[model samples]
Target: MTPEARKNAVRWSVFALVGAVITVSLLFGGVSDFHPTAVVRKVYDEVEALPDGSPILISSDFDPGSEAELKPMMDAVLEQCWRKNLRVIVMTICSPNSPELADSIVRASADAHGKVYGTDYAVFGYLAGGSAPILALGQDWHAVYKTDRGGTPCRDLPAMKGISKLTDFPLCLEISAVSTIDYWILAGNAKYGLKLGLGVTAVMATDYYQYLATRQVVGIIGGVSGASQYESMTRQDALRKARETKEAGDLASARMPTQSAIHVTIILLVVLGNILYFAGKRKEKASP
Candidate 1:
């Protein structure tokens, strides 16, 4: 075959293989749950140990751009918190759209677990002043957020009863996709000694490993794969809960198969491309 024809054949072949893999994986689960990483396991274990009615803060610092990757993470975490009967106080400092997104996830998870609103969970809308807001929240939550997204006073909310400051909560979870995670570490964790667990995009995962190594950050769920791992852990917990009562299992990791298929397809294409290039180079060298 001519060089042009060979290139076209290779390209079409790759497209066909990738498409098939993605379709099959999505239809029937492709990715198997591997062993949980240490950081992810720590996050799960900490949440698991929290007693019922314990208050925890979840800061979602991502916008719609990162919704696909971070939303599942948020849902899985919130579901676990609800299953443990923990009071979830969710807030956002990234975008104006974040509060609504956080609220929807929390409400859906709470409803699934038959948890009450206002009592079991509360979402304080976008807090202004960037790091300043986080600093104020750490010192005095009421000073920063007097009311929730709905305009109800924080004092009136049953979930915010004993939560006067950031340190009041045992755990602070940040589902972020930007530098907001750094802000949380510096302003909240460094100063207030707040224990933090992070759910960051894959791209930002490596940047924070040093924090985990230093014990500055308690745990991390990095990217979609990490989210899937946590989901698997949460699913096992749900199964145990199911034995006692009818409860839905975690579905946040359902997309793992698709992600895995795409990754594998890309890796195969890379190897194939490299082999073809070297083979063509050898043929040219032999001819001349």
Candidate 2:
């Protein structure tokens, strides 16, 4: 066979393998009720134990670039919060692009849980100056969040009552795609002593585990795998609540199998390409 035929054969093999994996991914993507990781469970349980009407803060520190990885985490956490009837305040800290992203995600979750804006929840939009805003946060809620993302006076938002500073919130969940998590750790957790949990990209997980050792962080929701785990646990919790009135066990359809397959396919594709490149190099060296 000619060299061209060999190249075609290798390309077709890779394509076929990826197609097979995608098929399997779709077939098993909907699996549920599986066990969650310890890190993810700690986060779920901590929020689960909060009393109804307890207020907490969630800082979404990612952009659209990270939506696929972090949005699921945000959704699962918000579902659990609303399931327990917890009051929430949403914000975008690290990523300037996240205000609209945060707004959209929270809006959907609020609607799903029949939550009322301004009363049950509020969205504080983006502020410039990088992590400098963290220092300004607890000093004056009104000065920092004078208005909601929609330009409504925060005072009109019933949810803003009793929240003066960062410490006013007993817990703050930071879901991020960048080093914003580190900034929050230093400013939000270490400086103010506020309790911190995280939902970070898979790559960021390893770097932040050091904080977990010191208990500086409560727990972590690391990437899509961790997000799926938390969603499973949330599903179980929802099941025990009243079926019609309470939150349903229906977490968003699982993304685990498909996400995993896509990740694996990408790795395999890179490896196959490298192998074929080397094989071709050897063939060229051997040719007359």
What is the per-residue lDDT of model 2 for residues 1-288, given as tens digits with 9 covering 90 to 100?
898998899789878887888787665455434578788888887898788888999999999998888887888898889888888999877766788999889998899889999888998888777667887886777788888988999878888788888888888999989887877888888888989999999888989888887989999988878877887766555433423343332343355656667788889789987997899899999999
Indicate the TM-score of model 2: 0.82
- Put down candidate 1 lDDT per residue, 1-288, tens digits, no spaces: 998998899789888988898788766663345468898998888888888889999998888898888887888788788778899999999988888878887788788788887998898999766789888988899988988999999999999989899999999999999899988999988988989999999999999989988888988899878887887776666434533443324444556667777998798789987998899899999995
Error of 2 at 247 (Å): 18
Query: Model 2: residues >4 Å from true position, as ranges?
Result: 1-16, 236-253, 260-288
Q: Which candidate is the best by lDDT?
A: 1
Residue 278 of model 1 has an lDDT of: 100
Off by over 4 Å in 1: 1-16, 237-250
Error of 2 at 274 (Å): 10
Position 154, candidate 2: lDDT: 81
